[model samples]
Target: MVKQVRAARTRQALVRAAAEVFAADGYAMASLPSISRRAGVSAGALHFHFASKDFLAREVEDAAADLVQKMAGEARSSSGTVLESLVGTTCRLLVAMAADPVVRAGFRLGSDPSRKNGPGVLAWWRTWVHERVAEAREAGELADDVSPEGAAAAIAAATVGFEVLGGADRDWLCEERAAQFWAFVLPRLAAFPQQAMATVTGAGGVR
Candidate 1:
């Protein structure tokens, strides 16, 4: 039992260390030795846990995807309207990316063109955003001038942009920046901006 626990802990540490290295250095530049050193594990142990860098990268992306799904599920179950739920989720996502290296690396890896993998976490996020935006449109929660596709694209692009910027400066992922984004878009996106803003502010959307 102790050996199993130790093994699990070692795997977790390796994943985290790899995420940090990948988040900082990108996939092409991240190395197995560096990840092992950061994790405080020997190369042999890292190899035992993960066969290759690609496998480790996939593990990080998978872990990050799970977190994103959890966040989306929470937002979907929130008592607020669809628009408010979307806003809340976006705020949570930026905050997560800011604080969690796993999430940060997941997004970074998802968007890295150098990596020959599939769309990864970004595609999952964008799909979720589109679904929610479409739901909001169907429910008359969005402004008449707004199209679901356009709103989804804009929201996805903006959030992904924040993740990218936050990579260099965490201030980009601050709550204030998220609030500013909602403030700028709410007027045009929400059918009743004031009510949505009120719910948002009360629900930790801003401040």
Candidate 2:
């Protein structure tokens, strides 16, 4: 039992190290040797845990997917309107990306064109946003001038933009920025003033 526990811990450490390295340097620049050094593990141990960099990256992506799904599920289950739910969901996502190395690395790897057969977390997120926007539209939550497709694309783009910009200035992930974004789009996206100007938890989530 102790051996199993130790093994699990080692694996976790390696994953966290990989996340840190990947988040800081991105895919093409990241190396397993560096990841092992950061994890305080030998290269042999890293090889035992992961066969290759691509393999390690995929694991990071999988972990990130789990993290995002949990947050999105929480937002979806919130006793709030669809628009509010979307706002909350985005808040959680931005916060995760900014605060969690694993998540940030996962996304970076997903979007890295150099990595063949990448996990495509960005694509997954786009699909998720697309579905929710469609649901909001069907529920008549959207403004008459808004189309579900357009709304989804615009929102996804903005979120991606934030993640990219946040890489340099973490201020990009501030809740104030998130609030401003939501407030700006709400008027054009939702019909009711209440929904448009709703008090939303912004990037990095509520304090």
Candidate 3:
């Protein structure tokens, strides 16, 4: 039992270290030795926990997906209109991603050619967004013409674009920037009625 607990702790420490290394250096540039050093463990230990760099990267992606899904679930449960729920869910996701080194690294990894189309992570994100958009549409918060799949895709793409553009240069302002990004999206996505538009614009404090 003690051995199992120690192994679990060691594995977690390695994951946290890898997250930091990947966030700072990008997945392609990050090395096992560096991650081990950051975790205060030997390279052999890291290898023991994860057989390969790809395995470690996939673990990071899974961790990020779990975190994102939890946030999405919580947002869905909160009180709000469908558009509000969508925007709120997205905002929470961005905030979590901004705060988590693993999530940031996973996002970078998902976009990189070397790690593209690995499994589950990006697809899960797309599906989550699509589900939320559909829910919003059904609730009369979104226009009838709005394509739930397309809008979800757009939100996912825009969120990624902002993250890439902001990069490490503007890490401090990620949440603020994420809010601004969603503000731009809310108006276009809400039902086209003047009252709906007004509510959205007013809620976001947009002029």
Candidate 4:
């Protein structure tokens, strides 16, 4: 039992450290030695837990997937119209990626060309945006000119773009910056000016 506990703690540390490394450096650039050192564990211990760097990356990706799934779930479940949910979901995600290293790394790994055999996080986010926009269109929230596919594409692109930009300047992920995005997008996409602006400038925000 003690050995199991120790192993579990060690594994968690390795995952966190690996995430830090992967988040800072792309998967191709990240190294096992750096990860082990970040975890404060010897190379032998890292090997004991992960057979290779690929395996370690997979673990980091998995952890990131779990975090993203939870974030998306919360945004979906949050009380609001599809439009509001869309806005809130996006804001939350930007904030999360900015604040959380593991969340940031998961997105990086998911986008990395080397990781095959699994659906990527960015793909999953795009799908979510597509579905939400469809719901908004059905509810008569979207402008007649705003096709669901087009709106989804724009939002998905901007959201991912923010991730890329925020890596260098974290201000891109802040609520105020995200609010600016909503301010720009809502005008073009929302059918009702009052309702759309209300959602964007809402005190409860993303409600």
lDDT of model 3, residue 27:
76
lDDT of 1 by residue, 156-176 (tens): 999999989987788898667
lDDT of 4: 0.82
Candidate number with greatest TM-score? 1
What tens-digit string does per-residue lDDT give for candidate 3 at 1-207? 999998999999988888888777787898999999999988888999999988888888888888877777776677356666566666665666667787777777777776655644666777777887888787777876778888888987877776576565555325556556666666667785554434234323222
> lDDT at 170 for candidate 2?
88
> Cα-based RMSD of the predictions, in order?
1.7, 1.9, 3.1, 2.1
Model 1 deviation from native, Cα RMSD in Å: 1.7
Model 2: how large is the Cα RMSD against the reference? 1.9
**If the candidates were sorted by their TM-score against the true structure, best first, what order would they fall in?**
1, 2, 4, 3
TM-score of 4: 0.91
lDDT on C-alpha atoms for all candidate structures: 0.89, 0.84, 0.72, 0.82
Expressed as tens digits, the lDDT of each residue in 67-178 for candidate 4 is: 8778777877874677888877778888888888887887888777766646467777788789889989999989999889989999999988888898889888766667
Question: Stretches of candidate 2 above 4 Å error?
Answer: 201-207
